[model samples]
Target: MLGIAAAVLFFIAFLINAADIATNDTFTSTNVMLIGLTVLALHVSGVGTGWGSRGRRR
Candidate 1:
């Protein structure tokens, strides 16, 4: 799920940067790319993979 989210963010960043779209300071392409990287890192680190709950006994 998160991987998909990251992919979408990357795509959006690419479009923004490649198309030369004008954006506000907060939503710049660089910022979107950075946020995507952060999300990817979190996904790689198992932050939201649901592994922890699966091991719990009912």
Candidate 2:
């Protein structure tokens, strides 16, 4: 899920940069890209993955 969200953010950032869309300081392409990177990092680190749900069997 987070990976998908990051991909969307990256796509939005690319569109904003490619189209030269005017945005507020808070909504800049660089900022959005950074946010996407953070989400990607979290996804890679298994933050939102449900791996912890499985119990270990002896």
Candidate 3:
């Protein structure tokens, strides 16, 4: 529940920033892709560590 709430808040904040940048013509596809890649990398790293720890515990 907390994770979902945080994700919702994050998405809302992202939308607000996106709207502001879009209005100013400052939002580029490259920037969006880079941000997406960064988030993906962080998620993968976190999940990998979590799974690895679980395997080691067995």
Candidate 4:
């Protein structure tokens, strides 16, 4: 679930950057990249979650 959220945010950021490139002469993508990268870091580090439910074992 966390991974899915991160992926969605990243995709949105990517689209924003892409649109900027397609419609303008000035290139600006740093803020979106930073937001996406921060989420990536959290997802990779397992800060809040990454482990499945702890109540069940199979």
lDDT of all the models against the reference?
0.92, 0.97, 0.52, 0.66
| Candidate 1 local lDDT, 8-36, one digit each (tens) | 99999999999999999998999999999
lDDT by residue (tens digit), candidate 4, 16-44: 67775653433245665566678778878
The digit string of per-residue lDDT tens for model 3 on 1-58 reads 3334445546655775667655333445445445555555666557433455445455
Model 2 Cα lDDT, one tens digit per residue, 1-58? 9999999999999999999999999999999999999999999999998778679879
Q: What are the per-model C-alpha RMSD values against the true structure?
A: 2.2, 1.8, 5.9, 5.1
Native RMSD of candidate 2 (Å): 1.8
Better structure of 3 and 4 per TM-score: 4
In candidate 4, which residue pairs clash?
none
Give the local distance difference test score of model 1.
0.92
Best by lDDT: 2
After TM-score superposition, the amount by which residue 15's alpha carbon in candidate 2 deviates from its true location, in angstroms, is: 0.6
- Off-target runs (Cα >4 Å) in candidate 2 are 53-58
* Candidate 1, superposed: residue stretches over 4 Å from native: 53-58
Alpha-carbon error at 54 in model 2, in Å? Answer: 4.7
Worst 10 residues of 3 by lDDT: 23-32
